[model samples]
Target: MNGTRGTIEIHLKELLEEAGLSKNKFCQRAELQRSQLNGYLNNTITRLDIDVLIRICDTLDCSISDLLEYKPG
Candidate 1:
């Protein structure tokens, strides 16, 4: 079996960290639950919501493109 999942990956945690904001701060500012945000940051989430992404982008002052990227594996 191929040990690869996909080339596309979410860089949410990196973007958030680059914003220089704590997870709690970002969650509060974005009106998002901490648990969900943690899931995203840890890459333990199975799916992502468009609304959440929009909110995160808005709060982080970053575009969706900045939150996602293609990394060949």
Candidate 2:
């Protein structure tokens, strides 16, 4: 089998903008730390946490698909 790689892109910034929510406000509402949310917004998070994802989705009233995109590399 050939080995290939893909990327999971986080659209948190766009989603937050579209929802008219500031980063700080979102952090408060989602019960996430600013640094943690920054990691997700900047796409620098090495590990994905299910609980965090759920909180984000719940706070934004969005599905997981709306917050992430998979790109073939």
Pairs in steric clash, model 2: none
For candidate 1, the lDDT comes to: 0.80
Best by TM-score: 2
> Model 2 lDDT vs. the true structure?
0.91
Model 2 lDDT tens row, 1-73 = 0116878899999999999998889999999999999999999998889999999999999999999888887
In model 1, the clashing pairs are none
Q: What does candidate 2 score on TM? A: 0.92
List candidate 1 segments past 4 Å from native. Answer: 1-7, 71-73
Q: Considering every candidate listed, which one attains the maximal lDDT?
A: 2
